[model samples]
Structures are given as C-alpha cells and as structure tokens.
Target: MRAELFDPRTEAVPAEWDKFLRDEGAPAAWDAGALAAVAWTSLRTVLLGVVADGGQAVALFCGDFGSPRRRNPVYSPVGGPGRPGVYFSRILMGFDEGFLFATHLDHAGRVAARRAFERALKARLGRRCLGVVYQNVSAAALPVMRTAARLCRPVSPNTVLVNRWQSMEEYFAGLPRDRRRRLRRTYADVDADSGLRVGAGVPAVDPVEAARLEQLTRLKHLSPGEVLVPLPSLYFERLNHRDGVRYFVHTDPATGALLSFDLSFEHAAGLVTTVTGSAAGAATGRGLYWDLYLREIEYAIERGVPRLEFGKGLVELKARFGCVTVPQYAVAAPL
Candidate 1:
C-alpha cells in the first residue's frame, strides 16, 4: 500500500475519498466539503489515503498540522510527556474527533496501511514532524488504532445524550423529581425574562462579535499552561454557509444584543454541538447555557435525531443532564 495526501484547497477531493467515508457511515463532519470549509489559519488540513496496488483505498483519514511558530499548547489535563507544545509538531486526526476508515481491511492490511500513512506523513513534514495524534478515539477503534501507535492514553470522555423521548415534555417527565423540578424552574425563569430570546437557524452572526465572545469563553475556561490559537473572524464567516451547520443564539430582544451562541452540526449519526461562546459577564443565574442545551436537545427530538453529542468536558455536569460518557483516548506515536 502507498500513502498519498490531498489538499482539498488546492485540488478537488478525489471522489473515492468521500465514497469510502460514505460506505463506512462516517459523520457529515468528515465529508470532503465539510473538511474543506475548515478555515483555521493556524492549521493546514489534508486528507490522507492508503491505496493498494489494485487502486482500492485501504485506509483514509483527515489530518491537520499546526503552524510551527504559532504552536497551540495542549490542554493541561491531556498534555502528554514533555512541555506544553509537545503535540504542536504532530498531525491531529479529524480535528476534535478521531476516525480511521479501514474496517474493510484485515488486521495485517490495517497495519500495513497505518505504517505507510505514517511514513508518508513523516516524509511530507520532514524534520518538523514529531508524530501523529489520534484524539478522542473510541473503544471500538482502539484495536485498529493500536496497530499504528504505541501510546494510548485515556483523556476526557465524549458526552452524548441519546434521545429516546418523543417530545420535550416526555424528556422532562423521565427525569428525577428534583432534577425535573430544577429544570422546569430554570426554563420558566428563562422564559419569564422577556429580554432574553433564543433562536436557532443559519449563522447570521457578526464575525467580530462572535470571535470576541468566543475568546472570552475560552479565557474563562482555559487551564494553566494551555495556549489556545485564536480563530479569526474568517473562520466563523466561512462556516456560516455550510450545509448541516446551525447556530443557536441567545439574544437580548430589547437591546438586540447577542449574549451567547452555540454551533451544532446535523449529521446522519446525530447532531453534534461543536463550539460555544458566551458574552463576558453574562448572567449565570439566568441559565443561558442550560437553555442552549435544551434548545439542542429539543432540536434533536423534533428532527428525530438519534443522539445529541455534546463533545468533551464537564463530565459530571453533562451527566446530570442525562448524558452518558463515551471514554476517549489519544493514540500518539513519535517518529
């Protein structure tokens, strides 16, 4: 098997690359078009594939390499050995979630493809390439991933709320009495605040305001030694027009101010909440965050989406909202 890299920005994404993802039932986030829409200035995105002599794709994955001088530091909790920027030189798989499409291959085939892909990756990046990191790897894919990397360390779990209720009322009815009472009260409080209104639709946000709010949220939650790369307004601007992408915004009706926003993606697998931003000094007692979560949950229920993925972090808090944790790991190999 020989490995090849494709830059969607420079050329058309080979049809076979998307075909493999579709055949494997990958999420919409992995679609070629979606990948191409990613506009982070600090990272270079590429699609990698391992093809056999017969021209059949044996392995496929999406990767992003961080800028050398502008390296982003790893989160303290999951930061591996060495300094904060140890992972800066590595290629990140699938941005936030890791996925390798190679179910069609046998064990030996998977190994060969992985080796070839790694070799090609190192060759492409040369001395600057320290390794490749597969983040948020699920348990089911661990075996296959093990064939490629030596380090498999547990990180935060991906939180998911599986939708079983038919309506918002049903969802509330299923919760425990105390939890249910709290949620009902919270919703009531939010509704009573005539000044606050929440809406969900295509992103119609001012990029400058959105970026400022996003950075504020990041600062509030940032860990020590963690350096986050600032996403330009262009990043949000580019994603605004993508299909299956939606933004839920909390606004002050009287003043017409955007207080907070959450970005979600609708995919065949489920609706995934990817990014969120809240205005500085936003009132926490108003339950704006919970309201956003409820909006997401209600959206999934209305659309008949099977699951609502909340991504990682806040394990206990998400659990209180009936979200189950799916353990995730980082598989890293140094060259």
Candidate 2:
C-alpha cells in the first residue's frame, strides 16, 4: 500500500480509506468530515497519501496551522489529522505539520506501515522540525513509531478510551455499589446548596468573566486552585460555533458562575467526551467529581450517543462513571 494526497473538497479520497480506519477503531476526530471542517481554518495542508494494493483503503497523515517559528510557552499547539500524505510548509514553527498515514499503522501493519510512513513523509515535507500527534492512535501504529528514525517528541499527556460494554446501563451497574451510591450522593450534595443552583446545557455562558473559564480550566486538571493557566481565547469564542459540536455546561443559577463545562463529539461509535472542565460547581462534599457522574450519563442519554467515551485512561475517577478503556496509537519517522 502507498499514501496519496487530494483535496477532500475537490477529490475523492475513497470511502474504503475511511472504512479501513473506522474498522480499525479510529475515533470521531478521524472522520473525513472532521478533517474538512478543520480545513475551514487557513492553516490546513495536504501532504502525501498512503495506499494499499489495488488502491484499496488506507490511513491519512493530515495536519494544520504551524506553530510560530518563534515559540511561546503559552501556546502549546499541536497538528491535526487529515488526508493521507498531506504536508504543511516550513512557514510554521517546530511542529512538523501534516498528515502522514504511516503513523499508527495497525499493529499487524506497523512494521511495513512504518516503512510506508517514512517513504511518504520523505516524498512530501523532507524531514525538518518536530511536534505532532497520531490522532485516535491504535496499537497498530505504535511499532513503527517506536523505531522511527526521526526526532519525535513522545507526548502521551492524554489518556485513551475503550468500551467493552453490551449496554451503558449494564456498564454502570457493573460499578461497585458503594461507589455508585457515593456518586449518586455527590450529585445531590452539590444541588443541595442554597445560594447556588446547578443546571446543565448552553443556557448559561459567561465566558467574558475569567472566573467561569477558570473553574472549568482547573477542573480539567482535577485541581482546585487560584493557579490559572492562560488558554487560547479562541477556545471560548469558538465555543459559540453552535453548528458542529454539542456542549453541555453545568452552571450556577443565582450568581450564574459556571460550575463545569463538558464538550462531546458525535462520533460513529458514540458520543465521545473530548474535553471537560469543572469548578466542581458548588463546593459540595465530593466537589466537582460527580457522585455518580449522573449528569454525564444523563447528557449522553439525552443525545442518544450509545457508547459514551470519556477520554482514554484516567480510570480511577472516570471509571466510576462506567467508562471502559479505549487505547489509541501513533507513529513517526525522520526525513
């Protein structure tokens, strides 16, 4: 198989390409539609392509926006996943921005896929820079990456998710009764506070006020502190998109101070919870952690997203919400 490049808007990348990746357990972030949506931004690029025998389905090495040539500690930017064999120019920074399919080749294909990735990458943007992500990685892609002859920065800061469930309810029922009871209690405990009332959805948005964003930002780290990290203002501005992604916010009624914010994407498998933040809402006993994560479960039910995937592997707390593990993989090589 080999990799190729074409505009999704103008060219046909092949349905089989998608079918192959999806069949391999690729997540929502990997959808061609998602790739095109990302292309809506100015920085998107089309590098190279990876194709198998008879031009069947294969993976993509997609990317977008280059980091500033001059680095800023504040901007911890990464690349995007896109059409196979796509490449972003050196006009960007340290990030080797583009889609190189050889990344995260299925484990069975990793050894060969790694060779394909290196060849594909060499064809487009000759080895330069560093920093990239193997979106929705799988074990297949790992082997090639482990042996890639490139300057790759290993970043596993986020966790992977897996779903080994017949039913979401059954998954929940699987949790220890005491843990389930505690989760239930936390939901009630937070609501009991008189001065602050808790609610969900987009009905309440006060992003202009740093306190609200701050609450969520902190909860992202599961931390409670005045310790604030500056975030891309665009994150909040883009939050108002209202067209593609669905957001569920937990807010304080009286003061309108945001307690938490969760963002989920409607993927083929289910509604994948990509990013979540919390102020712990009201300083209740269990704090921002839900007693039973009932709200998350309720939100998933409301959306009818059958399998709810909490980002992979912060198991201790997220597992209580009945999220099973889903692991992703990545691969890379030098020019």
Best by TM-score: 1
Top lDDT model: 1
lDDT, residue 119, candidate 2: 66
TM-scores, all candidates, are 0.79, 0.54
In candidate 1, list every pair of residues with a backbone clash: none
Q: Summing lDDT over every window of 10 consecutive residues in candidate 1, give the lowest-scoring window.
A: 84-93
Clashes of each: 0, 42
lDDT per residue for candidate 1 within 60-141, as digits (tens), equals: 7566654324345322212123222222211221225444555667767766776777777666655555667777777876
Quote the positional error of residue 126 for candidate 1 in Å. Answer: 2.9
Local distance difference test, candidate 2: 0.47
- Model 1 TM-score, all chains together: 0.79
lDDT of 1 at 231: 56
